[model samples]
Target: MCGIVGYIGKREIKRQLIEGLRELEYRGYDSAGIAVMQNGKIQSFKAVGKLSNLDEKTKNFETEGPGVGIGHTRWATHGKPTELNAHPHMGEYSYVVHNGIIENYREIKAMLEADGVTFLSQTDTEVIVHLFEKEIERHSDLFSAFKATIDQLDGAYAVLLITQKAPDTIFFARKGSPMIIGRNRQGEVFFASSDAPLIGEAEEVAYMEDGTIGYATPDLIHSEPDALQFVSLSGDKLTAQKGGYRFFMEKEIYEQYQVMGDTMIGRVLDDDIVFEELGKTFLEGISRIKLCACGTSYHAALTSSYLFERQAKMPVNVEIASEFRYKEPLLTSDTLFIVISQSGETADTLEALKMAKKAGLKTLAICNVDNSSIVRLADATILTRAGIEKGVASTKAFATQVMVLWMLSIFFAKKRATLDNHTVKEELRFMSYVPKVLQKALDVHEKCKRLSKRYLHGHGFFFIGRDIFFPLALEGALKLKEISYLHAEGYPAGEMKHGPIALADAELFTIALMPKTLLYEKTKSNVEELSARDSTILSISPEMFELADDFILTHPHKHPMLEFFEMMVVEQLLAMEISIRLGNDVDMPRNLAKSVTVE
Candidate 1:
């Protein structure tokens, strides 16, 4: 997930572009660059690393003439995170900053090379500017060349172009990634990847839908009327402040108790769950579900698979979005396709959603972003009220996704009469306790922090559980591996004997999830087997296991879902603490960005 900021305004070009890039740096910070029109020429400055580096490079530089420029904070995809591979990539006549991958860039680069074009950098984005230069030679008109170049590309992108031929305007196009255009009463136009950078800068904003190509000048903004989705930014502010926490991940882990309430606020009625967003005819004739997602969203989907089947009596199939399209699986009208993503701009999940729509299957999206590509493309959407999840590992988003999906299962059960009204009401009552359960879960934070030291040195981590807890175990392993740079795996407790148990030893640390409400004895017996193998067991449960080397006791809950929430907090805090103790970036992990906008 790279950040894009472009301005055609009355403000100082260098300061405005750099400040905007600073606001959007959380999207990416591997490298940063800016390009502005100065003295009838395209002036560019680039630096590797954070926005601070770019700011330092441009400290003595100033811009003259009309205020028009484009800037980028890159999360490298096609090339290494070096100055040569940073954004604001230039061709003979155009400079471009791009987010998302161009799948067919190699073919187009080959074609451009054969036509005597020299490339300066090894980036998929460099092909865009070169292609634009080639198309400008053929079309002559700037907008025509922009669309012509866009038409030739074969993958996801949100591109901002500044050309010497048309220095007064900033031409842009969005295919799969996110881009927003904003303007104020002073006739200043702003473009950013999200509303974060444009919040205080512009009075109103419009999200550019997929397949949209347009341009923004100081005095005017133009796009196809039907493609512009405008919203007034009267009081919208970036709410991703860390407050008093050391990192956004820490703050987000503690936010679950509050935001989870936001997810269920209006939906949880006295005795029924309602999704007002899903109109009367939304779930009609749905016979089965195919859930597609990647990474932690995949684990959330896997967790929901159990809920949909056990509670709603609905058959479910969960697939990793990256692998879903390659399998050539059957897609049918009776099967409702659901995709989950925290950013909603995940490349694989978005592509999977498109493929399902192409096959004519009714699609639903569970996402946090309001109008992301997947949310815009899906037939229906359940927006997770997790707000903005700034952490790359995702703590609140996963909890909210599973929370919403759990509610969806109950809603389905009530609608289909799969569960009696009393049972449905009981489920609703349990759902209401989630916020409190999450608060109690946070009580284990100190314990998790204290235990983090013991987990620092280990051969590898094994997070094991059974049934629904199995998915939670997988999520725990993912969190540990994500920020701590540790090798970890999650497995069904019973499957440990089959292949995984061979590595069990004193150095192997096992994090066992044993919720008393569901299959606790079976999972405990499995943990005991690992303990017998001389594995150091870290038991997370309401009851203390005597065979464990360490124990992080959780509050016992009436419902298994409540225990799941409790264990989730334990897992998240433990991972964060371990990462912190190891001197790793808690919020922004290496080799990873907050959003996976490219494959």
Candidate 2:
């Protein structure tokens, strides 16, 4: 995903455009550019690699006059992340910044080239601007031309256009990609890929729905009222201050306690779990659960299998969404296919949900975005309410998804009469204190940081656990390798001797999940095998301190099912701290994008 911003207001927008680009950089930072219509022509400046490069190019540029402008920070898709392929690509009359692909770009490009229209860059976005230029020639009105242009394009997109013919207006349209429009009391209007840039600047924001077209000017923004649903965003979230934390990742890691609490609110009542959107009848007659997801969401699904099997006494199957369809799963009336995604627009997950729906099986979605594609496709939906997860390595979203799964498991247990009222109350009470218990984990932040430093320079890392904790170990390994660029592997503690133990040595670091349970001795024996090879041991348990080279004590969970929640937070912090110590880009890791929209 790329970040795009547009400003059409009473004030000069050069500085605002730069500031907005910086705020939205988490979406992408491969290249940055800005365009303003000046003297009936487009004034465009672009550079490759980060907003800083564009800032350097515009250092001596003038912004004395008020102007409507649009800017982009790109995560390249159709072309390389070079200056030639940056956004704000111009045509005869328009300069445009675009997010999302044009599936038929080649067909459109070929038709335009046959007409002798010159193309500037190797981007599908350039094709869009040229098509818009052609549309204006016949339509004669900017709004008509913009709408006509969007009608011809296929695939997902959020487009912002500024043209010489309409120098004072900024026009935009979206289909299957996120876009927001905001307006202030002074009549200034702002547009961004997300609400990050509009937080403090605009008084009210309207999240644009798919297939909507709008335009903004210094005095007003014009669009169909029903196409958007406005929401109030806090100004405090827009501030650049990191709340005294070294990085946004660090700040977000700590925000988990609060956000996870938010996810639980109104949903978990006294001694009961409730999803207002789904009634008790929703889970009735469900013989099996098929969970489809990818990456972090898939690990959450893996953990859900344990909860559903043990607590709900139901059979649960987890599949990577990308492979689920290929396997040609046998779907029946009693099967409930659940799709989990933070963005809900994840392509493979969406496709898997579609396949399940086509087979006449019931579908459910666990997602953060209420209006996302997967939510729209599902028969029932549960919102994570984790808020916007900006960091590439997800923290709050994962915590909230697991929490929802546990609650769902309890709900199923109740329906099947497998869980007694006493057990339900105990689990509910445990869920209620999750936020406080997670905060207690943060109390040992310095210990995780210290442990990070000691193991930051290790040659490799090993993460091993059992049952529900096994998936958590996979998640921990993922966080470390993704953020820190470390070579890490995760395995079931019992399976370590099958093959992974051969890789153990003093040069490696082992993080063992040895929670005090029936299998604690087996996990401890796995740690002993690692220690025999002189590997440094990092234990994540209330006990097992004697077996660890460095141990971060986990606050005891009255219910064993809740232990993984605290373990996940500690792993997230350790990954962040290690990445920081290595001088790595903790938020936007190398060659990684936050949302994987493309296949």
Best lDDT goes to which candidate?
Answer: 1
For model 1, the local distance difference test gives: 0.86
**Candidate 2 C-alpha lDDT tens digits along 1-599:** 47889987647667889898888865435688999765566788999876888889988876656578899987655555688899889887789998777766889999999999988788889988899888888996879988888889976688999888887888889876678888878777888876678877988888888788888777766775344666666646434334446776776788787666656655566777766677768877888898999999999999999999998888888999999869878888898899999988999999999999899999999987655789778998887766667788988889989999988899889888889999898888889888887777787788887877788776888899988889999999999999999988888988978887888777889999877753778888888888887888899998756757888888775566667878888899899989988999898899887778877
Question: Could you tell me how far off, in angstroms, the CA of residue 445 lies in candidate 2 after the best superposition?
Answer: 1.3
lDDT per residue for candidate 1 within 36-114, as digits (tens), equals: 9954588899998777788889998887556689999876545557899998999876799997767678899999999
- In the predicted model 1, the residue pairs found to clash are none
- Positional deviation of residue 229's Cα in model 1 after best superposition, in angstroms: 42
How many pairs collide in each candidate, listed in order?
0, 0
Error of 1 at 194 (Å): 19
- What TM-score does each of the candidates earn? 0.63, 0.63
- Candidate 1 residue 206 Cα shift, in angstroms, is 34
Checking candidate 2 for backbone clashes, the offending pairs are none
